[model samples]
Target: MILILGGTTEGRIAASIVDEGEKTFYYSTKGNEQEIALKHGVRLAGALDKKELIRFCREKEIRLIIDAAHPFAKELHDTVYYAADELNTPVIRYERIYPKLDTDVDGIFQHLDYDGVMSSLREDKVRRLLTLTGVKSIAKLKPYWKEKGVQCYCRILDRDSSRELALKEEFPEENLVYDTPDESLDELLKRLRPEAVLIKESGISGGFLEKTAIIRQNKIPIYLVNRPQLKPSARTVDGEYGLRATIDEFLPQFFPLHTGISTGTCATAAARFAYAKILSPSPYVFIDKERIPVILPGGETIPVQIHSFSGSFSLRRIEATVSVRKNGGSDPDVTHGMLISATVSIEWDHTKEMRLLKEGELPEIIFHAGEGVGTVTLPGLGLEVGGPAINATPRKMIRENFEAVIERACVPIYSTPIHVTISVEGGKEIAARTFNPRLGIEGGISIIGTSGIVRPFSSEAFVNAIRKEMEVAQATGAPRIVINSGAKSERMVRNQYPDLPPQAFVHYGNFIGETIQIASELGIERVTLGVMIGKAVKLAEGHLDTHSKQVTMNREFLATLAHEAGCSDETVSAITQLTLARELWTLLTPSELTAFTSLLISRCAQHCQPLLPNGELTVLLISEEGVIYG
Candidate 1:
């Protein structure tokens, strides 16, 4: 249903994001040399002309095309662009993150093309040169190095194929140097000491900064080839998360399951826009017609709709109130459609505070818990007791957002404190339906979300999805189908079964009972169930559905295991006091842990093996730190 043109790192990342679901997709590359891991993606290696591309899209019924190939692949980019346009298929360009501006070094020069570099080389009368540009650029610089009779050393990837390419171009063997960490950039510069260095403006991930740092230190004249400008496609996303979100939008019905944003992101977007209004003109305050852009934790900026708020101001303090109604997408989040509000109050200070007086310091930020947000009632959740229940991640996002607003507006952060209060509409009524009440969060719901994006893996929806996967495994003739609790467990167990196909592995996401039942009905003979400590503890107690709502971790049951495993009285008591199951790794001795883990997994197997009576079941216990034992 989707085709991704990839032969680069961004292409691999895009494949991983799209592979999250059970549906099949295609990943194409110019060569088969680039090693990439994929599960649901069918790898297609070879350059596709416009005819081949359009034919493939039609044959495969590809509704979406992701151009994640190298930025310099202009011909391929053009082919895909025009093909997609002809087919009326949406294309999401996975653009790489590049420096906002060229590196400001005295010796560094920018060239629009290789011809300028050759012209500059002739002007400088340079005979010796060093190029950090890739092997493909060697052909482009033939006139400068070969025709001009200049001795140029080219650095390329340390691989047999690269050396073969250089040889095929008739480049001197002595002129080819492989890029290796064993040879430091500084050491390379010292040995060569060429008159100039040539590099591509390859951004941070390309090791451009590392290369330039040494070149700058050596004071060598360097020419950086500007990256080819890409025409604006239908849509573009820099990060994998953003790519996934865009894919969901373009192919709204491609995957049966759709992803959603976190409540933390919703709150951060609301708070971010509320503070931006403080710096905006009077007319911008009441007009909430435009969607406000908020940068997510993953470094992707997304626009969120903000409601009109009552803006007020005072001489010493200016305050703005804004709300973002949470969109839960395909997830059945209790806070869906709830109004998450942020009230930002800015004050001017006559007396400079310590933060303002410090070097490289901004204004102090203070957070408040308003009407529907919860307060921390206990420790161990990593929040100060009696403080606002906003998580550390949300707090960081809020501060970053506020600072971006201040810097963008070019306004000084005054010495006074800027207070931000977050409130969720009807959050208290919803808290009872969530784990907040049991987690000792009082008053209302807590601002949460570790990744700022939630995978829609709810019970009924996930079960239906897994049934399709089980049928696929049966049809594919897989030796054994792996059923992990979720992504975390699946990742940890991947090394154990490196040869297993991605389709052979499935994410059960708290549906242990249902997944095994489907496997039994589908005649899946061998099943490997991977579970983390948290779910292992609950599954050991015979809970078919190990959902947080269906089961709270029973410390009493864990204490019994610790006691039976010959744990000391103190250890047994400590198990009862544990806030999370993973804490058992720290609370018990190594020997005691091994015994307890065995007892736990055995109990889990006892309950699970019956579900797959006609099949063999292997239970894997993944530790908190991702160590797998059983």
Candidate 2:
């Protein structure tokens, strides 16, 4: 659970961001203000003191705190820090972006603290002063003004509390200016005609710029009070996106939402459990005697369950097997609920064991493709031709897990040779639905996982894959790279560039922006983007993410492109009436098709040039019939 101390724009955005899966509570100090509507799982509550706040966090099981309150709310900020310290919880401060002061202007005084404001006022000996700071600090300034006999005017919110604060401070009714922040202070400034303006350094959202500009235009001296200095230990972010990123770091677990452990993670857990069982008495090495933690590639540790385990040991041989059910969550994957198993067998090898012991090294751990597991038969994949279809990430995971088990148990690995076989139940049938058949991974699905954890429908994972593939291509000393939308386009591109190595072709999967940006960053000399008409139209309109859910094909946009291509009104109308982008081919004549294709390719190139600033880009539009729009 998370708690957000919010009253400003940043607070509202933070609430929305953390409110998705976590139970978030938004705290506000103002009671009379209108309540802002929030999404599900976010509850709005009134303010609490330090002790009360600590009690609330404990009662609610809050583990993270996001402080997005006003910068001037020193009391509230202090309370949040104290409560977080007492609860031993993490706190992220969403600080506002302060506007740059115009130091070039004459007769402007800026102070880092409130004392500087008082010093400047005392030095100036100003008789009439106008304060744009809120009513909360009026009491502090009243003493100084009264001692100096300076007639002070203050602009505050038009609320009963604000008026009462001024009245109790003995500020005259005529000198009290009651208005909201957005309301212009022109009337009050003109009526008072003060020699200077006193204000706090509220950020842009707090009308700091507007107040400064108005005071400067009136030729009034400005005294700006800097915000209080916060603790250096507090993590501070300046924007809504930064706040979201901070919150994600604090609470890294994916919950009731659509997320899953990768197949590689499942295989690693099974292999590790099986290997651990061979060394330990129990089948699992429980963390704190509760659960087993499988560390993913990204350094995130997730608890996995061992569904079943069995082992047998003899005089010269040891055998163990473990199974873990794959959980794909909401990802549209074929192997969602399948069981993945790993069997480990070790035999005494005297000759090899003697050589290994002489060198003080462990014996080799061999891997095998068991039943329902595929074998690589292609040259493009980063594996031996006859090796198991487990990719490099999963292979590394398995080796790491095995080594971890050996190190934890101090097993005598130098005396034995081990072989581990990884298998998936019903994976061969599932491979037919994936790209394994076309990729030449015969018989079964590949044991593939890059991050070891699947964020359902994760665009980040797709974009990351494109980046990794581009990096691999760049590492191959390939001067040119081919970027495609999917496997079909990649195959078509391969036919076009037959001589180029397979590493030179990458499937972007609706991540055109990321692909181009990565290509430019990798300093590739040339890039060819092969896309279908549906995605091409979206790209032409500057929608880099061409996913249907992210951006729909704009019929009017297509019609406009057609009109620009010198099509007739009737033809344009027919194109607009068409439902799918591919339907336009049937509606257009040969000349119109040429014109439309030319315009689309031109538009795509125009939009892609900025992303490929240092590289050359070529756009290829493929039709429904596999015809290239050259």
Candidate 3:
């Protein structure tokens, strides 16, 4: 058994690349590790201390350990190293990929240490400091900025805590401390022009490329921070080559009986196989109508229809002008119907078998594992089911049309039938983001029409979805509803309640009161509210509606707390308004953080109790202390 300590994306990807047959374990400090692990069919272990780590490994009978923990998680890394040394198990620390600065930017400066950064900033004019750095480093800059009296603006993550931090710091309410870049940098520059920009070399997905574009457009001096270098003792790999080489080298060691097992070659061979099947001469027509038969590889059959197709090749640009007629006539005037021209696209992976779903006119490729297979539909070709439901009908027919013709068949017809991917010319790029992340639904949005017709509003559908999800959660035998605004809390909640399935936890997303009410209505016997500090204060103040628009900084209440604690109004307001419960604790010395966390937890408990008077309520507040209440 392989125990893989994974916190970073690289670790996840590395784990994903491991042999399909190997039993792999992926561990995370935060709670969502289980869902992720389950999705990929990997064994998951929650955040564990040094002793717990040893016990877990020994009990699980783990043979090898892979420490793919975040570069910054030194304690966890040390624990893994120590655990391996004691258990006498070999450990491989998968090195994380860091952002490599482009050679074009000349005046950009890079720093390793925070103190060094402070000193370096002090040397320059440093006016209008745009800390593209994370919120974790904000406190360090606060003391310096307070003394220096320099105008500083930090671009933190556009999260609730970051927003609250900005509000607490009194960093110009109108000029946001952090923002998501939907608009171009040129537009953003016009909004908040800065002389200098400080940014971390966060990898590709971290929006470093966009940051560079913004910086270059504005021609602002940049203070770039480099990632911590790996220790010399650790084995390392370059981008794709390292990952490929490691798997190749390790595969033979483990599977000596298996020959010709190259990861790259396998992927290529698989791609070829999928392509060959798609290009092969086969029956591609559907005969569903009686008496009058219509062949539709393109369009011109059904009136007002939805065609769903799935294949290896891209069909994003394969637009078909569809014309539909009633029964047996092609008279446009007699048909009295609608015409739709739409792009046909397919989502198929080379690694999986053909599993097509035929629901009326729509044909979808049912994904088994990571692969998609050819599944085509002609929306205009009215099938045996007659005219599809008005809402069930697609506006157009979309079928994958491969741009390239393959002459050579690499694999034999019976050689385990390796699947190959269809190279849909423009299909892949068009579906880049939608196909990869978010919405557990992978590949792309299913070409589905439930109502048969597109309606003006979809709010009722959303409510129905939530209701169904709630019912599903309740069915899982989770008595206590765990509603969290953060992903981490839900994970921790699951760890605490191993019997309770993950779906039971609802991500309320700033709808604390609404979630509570829903749980109460749904007959949830109890509820555990998990929240960070930013939302805690409002909850304490009986501002049940914690929406920022509904909440005003209760200056008087904060002033009173400050006076009771013997602090200034500014100090108290700042402390009270802090989104981070940990930071609020910092205002009070070492002894004070707990007191502060406790006070806030009490406030939250008091505010929450009456909302769900019938249910047993437990508000678990997580601050720097970690889980102050239960």
Best candidate, lDDT-wise? 1
Per-residue lDDT tens digits for candidate 3, residues 97-190, read: 4444544545578788667777788888575677777665666566656655677766666677667766677555554554555755567666
Point out the worst 10-residue segment of candidate 2 by lDDT.
Answer: 353-362
Q: For each candidate, what is the lDDT? A: 0.81, 0.75, 0.48
Question: Tens digit of lDDT per residue, candidate 2, span 1-630?
Answer: 777778776776565455445344555544536344454334555768888888878888888888888898888888988888887899888877675555666446888866678777888887789888888768878666777478888888888878988889887878888775555687678878998888888887677788788777888888888888776677777654345445655776623334567789888988888788888866444433233457566443455777777778886788888888888754547888899999998887545524334322445778889888999886556678898988888888877667667667764556466798999999888888776766679988889886676544444655655565676567556668999875457766677787676567777767788889999987887999999887999999999988655777788999899999999899998876654576777788999989989999999999998999988898988876678876
* Whole-model alpha-carbon lDDT for candidate 3: 0.48
TM-score of 2: 0.46
lDDT for 66 in candidate 1 is: 92
Candidate 1 regions exceeding 4 Å error are 1-3, 12-28, 31-63, 82-89, 97-132, 147-151, 155-170, 177-226, 279-303, 307-310, 313-315, 353-363, 400-411, 464-507, 512-532, 582-630
Off by over 4 Å in 2: 22-26, 41-47, 147-149, 180-183, 254-545, 548-630
TM-score of each: 0.77, 0.46, 0.37
Between candidates 1 and 2, which one is better according to TM-score? 1
lDDT of 1 by residue, 1-630 (tens): 989899877887677667656679999998888766665779898888999999999999998999998878889989998998899998988887765443463567888889998898889888899999989888898888786568899999888878888888888889998788789778988998899999998766577778887898998988878888877855777775678778777777666776667789888988888888887766244554667767767566666677657677778778888888887777767888889998988876656552433423567788889888999987667788999999988998898787678767765555677799999999888888888877789999999875576665665776777787676556556799999865556767989998876567787878899999999998888999999888889999999888786788999999998899888999998777777677787778999989998999999999999999998999989885689888
lDDT of 2: 0.75
